[model samples]
Target: MGQDYKEIAIKLFKQGKFDLAKISFNIAFNETPSDELLAFIELCDMAKDSPSDALTLFEIYFDPANDDSAQSINEIIDIMQSSVQQSTMEIESQNAITYADFKNLLNQNDFRTLFESILFSTRIIITHKDELFELVNFLVDHGFLDIGLKYLEGSAKMFMGDERMELMLEKIRGKDENSLK
Candidate 1:
């Protein structure tokens, strides 16, 4: 987007028109991902006290090979660890789930980022097979797609497209686990 829109977005954020600022950012993002704009969005979300979403933004900004990705991941670690909601290893429903914020790990340096991500957040027990399936599938598609699928197709495999699985997929789809893609 042009500087005009970005200017407007800044104005909106400054004026506390957070939702509008988000819309403006959306316009910029749809046109092209801007690391700078991503930073602004992070600031905006932080201004709004929604660091959870900020966590998503870093996933897009970071590319492992870049010299800054690891630093960014460390920043993420500080942010997530600081959040009161996620400080402890427990969140009630899966909704409270802190996604595996691993884009920085995807950066080649943090080979075990995913594992660390999973370990850091809450992982609900697999009770009702339906919710269990959805969680598993989410882990597959976002956290560990190949492994998740393998688990699905393997001995512990449950049929995909089960009504339960589909709902979870829908919810997960709406969540931009990774800000970039």
Candidate 2:
């Protein structure tokens, strides 16, 4: 049964159906836990969350004995950076939002950075929980409930067992439910 799921996951992964692949990989891991399968699951999760970081994930998971991959990964990073620059240029031309306003907003609140970071990255190393909870409440109060919910859902595992995180998760979940009505 585990092998069956693993096969399905591999196929899904090759097809770029990362979310489905992750689901299948999780099922496979639960049935017959292996480090390789777990790594694949992690890759699938990362791929689903940040498709642009796929090469980074590949570098992390691959064997260190192979050295040729570094140059290729560097090239991929360069290409990605170029693409991001082009997108930023396009956005700058079209959007009315000014750099000063964005800078001021970020400077005005530390949690806003946390919200933006968690929105993009699957994992973020955060040392401050007080600021995180404060940001969650601020976002929720300011009608950024969807962004707050996404950040909480993504970061909940890392901050698990903290009463504040749990409470905010519950609050965001309730808000999400109500908003759907």
Candidate 3:
């Protein structure tokens, strides 16, 4: 019975149905208490709340402690990647929401609040050079110079020697300088 619930929870979790997964994990925990099940419950809660937080929790807490850490980490990574991919696809499906529309959104809402909400909630794994470039450009253009620079610097290893990435770094630096002036 407990194993049955655990299996259901895992399936739901992989499907990005964290709410249902959490309930299933809870039921499983009640039936057969274990640290592993408790961790899964906590992971489901965090993933439901925010994928970024879930990834952080898994990296900082679960990965180090678990005996079967590799499998656990892989599962969490899969969930985060899937969620990010789905979000990316949705944004793409909307035709990338024209720059003017996005600017309007930023103007109507507080940009800092909105940007922070996205930055904290989503674990953006840039799968393409274009995605990184576009994201850095958007951040810098929207006055998130520091964040843009941080992202550019962090991605430097992956994008090293890429002309577009170099141009983006220069653009971010140029913006940073102008802002300081």
Model 2: weakest 10-residue lDDT segment is 119-128
State residue 134's C-alpha deviation in candidate 3, in Å: 0.4
Tens-digit per-residue lDDT, 71-100, candidate 3 = 675666566568667877876665344344
Evaluate model 3: give its lDDT. Answer: 0.72
lDDT of 2 by residue, 1-181 (tens): 9999998987887677888988999999999997667667766655644554653655543548766655544554455557557756765665333333433556766755644654444333322455557666878966688777776787777567778887887787788788889
Q: What's the ranking of the predictions by TM-score, best on top?
A: 3, 2, 1
Give the number of colliding residue pairs in candidate 2: 0
All candidates: TM-score: 0.31, 0.35, 0.39
Q: Model 3 TM-score?
A: 0.39
- The sequence of per-residue lDDT tens digits that candidate 1 reaches over residues 1-181 is 4566777886787566776887787678667776666656655656454434653544443555557764664565566456645544445435334333333334554434545556546353332344446445646455555445443455233444456555555545454455447
Q: In lDDT terms, which candidate is top?
A: 3
lDDT of each: 0.54, 0.66, 0.72
RMSD of 2: 12.7
Better model by TM-score: candidate 2 vs candidate 3:
3
Of 1 and 3, which scores higher on TM-score?
3
Question: Which one wins on TM-score?
Answer: 3
